[model samples]
Target: MTTHVQLHDRLDYQSVMPLMEELKAITDDDLVIDAGNLRHLGTLPLQVILAAVKQRAARGQTTRLANASDGCVDMLSLFGFTPETLTQPEVWT
Candidate 1:
């Protein structure tokens, strides 16, 4: 089954740790991260997502970022990421 993790409106330092912990706890199944409601995108949260995507790849599990907000898209672009690239990890690697 696919696991869905919904991102909060504000992904700042205070809340990013718990978010990272949640991502780290997923050991099996595919993951779909919902960024539709994301208002603020922070570097820490982006790192957490990248790590989760990498871990899932190592385990042969899929990780997709869905419904990304404009803010999320803009922030990701700063790091050379596009919305489509989030679902297709091989594109950047």
Candidate 2:
């Protein structure tokens, strides 16, 4: 089954740890991260998400980032990540 994790408005230092922990605990074969509410994106949370993606990739699982807000898109692009790349770990790696 697919599991969905909704991101909060802010992903700064104050919230990164909990986001990372939540992402790490998801053992679903497929993960759907809802970024529609994201208004800020921190490097730490980005790293956490990437790590989660890579780990899932190693297990032949898949992760998808969905409903990205404009802020989320801009933040990702600032880090040189396109929304398309999140679903394809190999593309980012």
Candidate 3:
């Protein structure tokens, strides 16, 4: 009932749109995405993740970002994405 996405290497503008589209496939049952392998994550990549989170929120679904490297989390923080956004809300059920 759910899908998971892994953030591979080089999440720059060149790879973000497709990644975003692919991430859109994630359903509620999917949990703990592995993004630790990402080597070069940019602001676009952070936006992609944010978009996915917002999309899931809009649908009242749950999305989890798992194994995210500290660098990736820092990148997201730089783009104004709070760590709280990555957590699943228990009220959604």
Candidate 4:
């Protein structure tokens, strides 16, 4: 099953906890997307993604992000996380 989190606006500290809960509820291996709707992603938001990635890694699951705004891309690069940022996907669903 795929879990898609469409972040239409700001993705900051306020959004993380609720998203974590939603992600926790997901069963079976799946995908998560902070998709086309996302606009701004602050430092806390980037950290949130990092944390989620680590958590999923621990569980042997995978999470892929998509449609990151240019600002989001800049922020990821600013934080030195560009390598992990999902830009083009081999298979996007």
Candidate 5:
């Protein structure tokens, strides 16, 4: 089964811990991150997302970002991440 984690409007420092815990709980399933509502994407949260993607890849699982908001897309692009790059586990490195 796939586990979905919806990103909130503000993905800042305060939300990172809980989000990490949520990601940890879904280690056994394919993970889908709903990014359509994201307004602010902090560095820490971005790190967490990258870590989750890398971990999933190591476990032979998948992690995907769906419906990315413009803010999310722009922020990712600042780090040189395209939608296609985001799906590749290697990009997290």
Candidate 6:
């Protein structure tokens, strides 16, 4: 099964709890995170994403961060992360 979640426009401290809940609720084999609306990516949510990725990795599930906007990509790059790096479990460490 694949669970797809559309990310909010701002992934900051204010969005962490709900975002975490959304990610945590996924019980599928594939997790598809649609980040096309992102305008800002904060450190806290970045951790949340990494944790989710690791969790999926440990469970042998797969995750994909897709359709990110240019600003979203820039934000990830600011933190030294590319879209590919976000999904690869090994890069989290």
Q: TM-scores of the models, in the given order?
A: 0.87, 0.94, 0.72, 0.71, 0.91, 0.95
- TM-score of candidate 3 to 2 decimals: 0.72
Instruction: Name the candidate, 4 or 6, with the larger TM-score value.
Output: 6
Question: Best candidate, lDDT-wise?
Answer: 6
RMSD of 4: 5.2
TM-score of 1: 0.87
Full ranking by TM-score: 6, 2, 5, 1, 3, 4
Model 6 misses residue 19 by how many Å? 0.8
The clash numbers for all candidates, in the given order, read 0, 0, 1, 0, 0, 0
lDDT of 5 by residue, 1-93 (tens): 878889898988998999898888885568788999998889898888888888888888987899999988998898788656886877556
Candidate 1 lDDT by residue in tens digits, 5-50: 9999889888878998999888767888999988887888777788
Q: Write the per-residue lDDT of candidate 3 for residues 1-93, one digit (tens) a residue.
A: 767676786788888778877876566555456778765777777767766766677777777777777776776566555345555433322
lDDT by candidate, in order shown:
0.83, 0.89, 0.67, 0.63, 0.84, 0.91
Candidate 3 clash pair list: 2-30
Model 5, TM vs. native = 0.91
Candidate 6: worst-modelled 10 consecutive residues by lDDT: 84-93
Who is ahead in TM-score, 2 or 5? 2
Q: Model 4: residues >4 Å from true position, as ranges? A: 83-93
